[model samples]
Target: MAEKKQWHETLHDQFGQYFAVDNVLYHENTDHQDLIIFENAAFGRVMALDGVVQTTERDEFIYHEMMTHVPLLAHGHAKHVLIIGGGDGAMLREVTRHKNVESITMVEIDAGVVSFCRQYLPNHNAGSYDDPRFKLVIDDGVNFVNQTSQTFDVIISDCTDPIGPGESLFTSAFYEGCKRCLNPGGIFVAQNGVCFLQQEEAIDSHRKLSHYF
Candidate 1:
């Protein structure tokens, strides 16, 4: 006779049946709104505050579009792009919008986040994971900035909130590293810290960035 399956495994399988599909209503971290995922999930949002913040099966385009286009347009003729901490590949999707782009690199500290985004947030990023132009480096953004000899035409910051693992990305030292990674005329655009919870920190970052540029 076949051995009986473990009771723990049976219980775990049963628990999965209780899961309720839901969407993200909204997520406002101390630094920014990380994202609202899922249709009926807790923070999933269909129509947000502006009514313009509409939802789809995917949630990455909004963040990617805003972060990439603004800087690309402002700088003009982006040939190469680097993304710091945008593990979800949202920024990658938007960076590819430039036909002039020659290469794109993203340094995200967490490989798991990239995997999750690819699996769960397909619509948000529009399957950017499969794009050939994207090169994902599962390394610390700070480290990548210091080591990379090649410069970028645009550097978009796609870091997490400051409260957790992403704290250092907002520091002056990281900004210095960012300055080093830029080509002569490259534009560096980051989240700039948060305007609300970290207002003072944001001011300080702005001051630091001004000093660099």
Candidate 2:
């Protein structure tokens, strides 16, 4: 009879040496996409939804930095910020870069994502989860903006791609709500889908945004 393989041996065979470089979470799937969650020494914990790498815990800073800083610097000063759909708190970390920022409201539809990040994605949050300057609301982004009368100096939509649960975020109604939620001089920005693969949608979205703003 063949001897049983050791746990490490089995893992190495399953994921290969590259996959074992640094792992935070790991699970295999026979019916659906193979889920592999790992921490890159530089990028942090990353979730692979369907064998495709999702958000990483570490390098998220690069995206958040570029997304938040360019606008803030161009605007010269920003005191209030609103983030939509950044459940991982990465954007919030970047938005707080301005010391003058008095308040940051984060609207995330799924609190589970946030909770998971708090537990396993420390590199992204950096313990900002409990910061008094930050207010987290687990609610629909559209509804939150619709009900909110307070305006913001900058509104950043850090949502996922326009599929799955984030479809409403890219709708005309959503943009209307965003316009209403922004201060007179407020700037609104969102990370649209890939420019190469989603050119038409991108163009349409820009046209819609132009109409609203």
Candidate 3:
């Protein structure tokens, strides 16, 4: 019999979790970060980037629904949406559920992340990528926000924790750039890390975002 492989989550220094890899689906070092997808008994298919778990097929709906829907609902009649760094397409899936949303532009830093996730984790995206209103831009989220002339009613930052390629997304300058891309009365929502482990990150983000919003 073969030995089981284990994947350890590297999100926290003091405490962490591990997954039993039932199978290795895909693994690669993309231009931006290290990406890995594997099967687990509990989580179904798991995608991790830079040693941190991004999403799992089992519980993805919980995170994706909250991150994409709450602000869109609050904004009321949001027709255009911008998603930054959701290469997995799970955010895209939830946003597309809104029949009134006429357009969705997802800015992802790594093309490989999107491609691999589409191949290995179809359930996450659920063909939302093929929607006529969906546009996939292969670019850094910060640069996209800064350069785009178009404005959106809701901007969703589905970025990873502030590290590696995602570090710039949490900066004050990036927040300011996103502000520039929002329509008047626009709502911006982001995935800050777990509050218990990343309290300082939440505080810093609040301090920076306060300058713009």
Candidate 4:
């Protein structure tokens, strides 16, 4: 008999939490960082970047719902939306649900993540990519926010943990650029990790966002 393979590691900013991977569906290192899709007995299908758990099949709707609706609904009106990161398209799927939205633009730092997720993580996208009102931009999200003159009624930063290329997405400069990219009375939302899990992420993002917006 052969022993089953088990994967264990310290992931993200969790001091003692660990991920024991049961099965690997895809693993690759893009120019940005290590990307992986694996299945765990408890978590079901999961996506992680640089060893940090990102999205899981079972509980994705909770995160996607909160990240999408609170801002869009609070703003009272949102016709155009911009999504940063979330190459998996989970956020995109939620944003497009609103009939009031006229158009959507998503800027992802790495196209590989998008392509990988689109194939291996098809449930997240939910055919939102085919929507005529949606446009995909594969580029550095920070650069897109800084350069694009277009404005949106709602902006969502569904980014990874603050590390590697995602580091720049949480800076004050990035928030300022995002503010500039928004139309009047616009709502901006970011997926800052839970304070208990990744305290710095939530605190740093709040500090920067407060300074800029």
Candidate 5:
């Protein structure tokens, strides 16, 4: 029998599936969770959180574009934007694409993730972090949303799965805080994973958001 490759992903474990890896590029354990960046022959660079695949360089544009554009385009003339948990900055890159967006403030609990992505997965960020209009706040997204008096035309919470440090972003209180920070008629977008894989989280998020927004 051939030796099996190690797949470091909780989702795979949870679903009883497996992930094939071409190479493991970087790995580390943060105070929060384990971070791993690797390459697959098909996916290029892949970033995983606590062993779960978060973003892959190959299909990231599709995700970031849809997540950032739909709400902003529909809202139509947003100036200020607030992003929570997008420590990788891909969402920030897409948000700045709108010429009407004059400012962007991103709140991320893990600064180390930002630095890691900046250095290794540079393609995701596209220089957005260095943009003068973009401001990166290294703090808990939940607290920032609840505490910031500044209102925004759009709020995008590009968070990880609803577990570990990201669990708070999925709650009713967080939704209320997001609503509190929104300008009149402003919109909020959150990337909830596929319902088939995260049924409870998806339904629960919808329920909480409906209650607040």
Candidate 6:
């Protein structure tokens, strides 16, 4: 029998999680970060970036649904939606479910992340990448939000933790740019890392976002 393989999460030095890898699906250093996809019994398939677990096939729906639905439903008649840093396409899948949302613009920093997820983790996207309302723009989220002439009814920032390429997304300037791109009464949502593990990040983000919203 082949020896079992395990994948360890490098999210924190003191506490983390690990998974038994049933199969190594894809692993590579993308243009922006280290990416990996693997199969596991408990989570089905998992995708990680820079040693942090991103999405798993089993429970991705929970995160994506909450991120996409609550704000969109509350806004009631949102037509144009903007998504920043959701290269995995799970956010796209959930947002596309709202028939009222006419347009979805996804700005992802790494094209490689999109490509790999599309190929290796098809379940996460569920063909939403080809949705008629979906548009993919490969660019830094900060630059796109700051420069885009267009505005949106809802903006979802499905970024990673405050590290590496994602560090800039948590800054006050990014929140200000997002504010600039919002139509009247627009709603913006972001993935603030687990509050217990990243209490400082959560606090800092709230402090920055409070200035604009």
Judge candidate 3 at residue 33 and give its lDDT. 89
Write one digit per residue (lDDT tens) for candidate 1, span 1-213.
553321111112224212123434333321222332334343232322111122333454556688889989988888888998765555777777787888888887766556655665565567766778778888878888888897888998777545455777887778888899898888998875437645777887788888788
The CA lDDT of each predicted structure is 0.65, 0.73, 0.94, 0.86, 0.87, 0.94
Q: Report the lDDT tens digits of candidate 2 across residue range 1-213.
A: 554321121222235223334545655552322445565565556755434344675566678888889877777778888999876677887877688888999998876667666666677777776778899988888998999977898999987666655778998888999999898788898988677667877998898888898
Query: Which sections of candidate 4 miss by over 4 Å?
Result: 1-3, 12-14
Cα lDDT for residue 34, model 5? 85
- What's each prediction's TM-score? 0.73, 0.80, 0.98, 0.93, 0.94, 0.98
Which of the numbered candidates is closest to the native, going by highest lDDT? 6
| Candidate 2 wrong stretches, greater than 4 Å | 1-36, 40-44, 48-53
Model 4 scores a C-alpha lDDT of 0.86
Model 6, 27-107: lDDT tens digits are 999889999999999999999999999999999989999999999999999999999999999999999999988999999
Count the clashes in each prediction.
Answer: 16, 2, 0, 0, 1, 0
| lDDT digits (tens) for residues 70-174 of candidate 3 | 999999999999999998888999999999999999999899999999999999899999999999999988888899999999999999989999999999879
lDDT of 4 by residue, 43-158 (tens): 78888887677888989999999999999999888999999998998999998899899999999989989999999888999999999999999888888999998999999999
Which scores higher on lDDT, 2 or 6? 6
Model 5: which residue pairs collide? 9-51
Instruction: Choose 3 or 5, whichever is better by lDDT.
Output: 3
The 10-residue segment of model 4 with minimum total lDDT is: 8-17
Candidate 6 pairs with clashing backbones: none
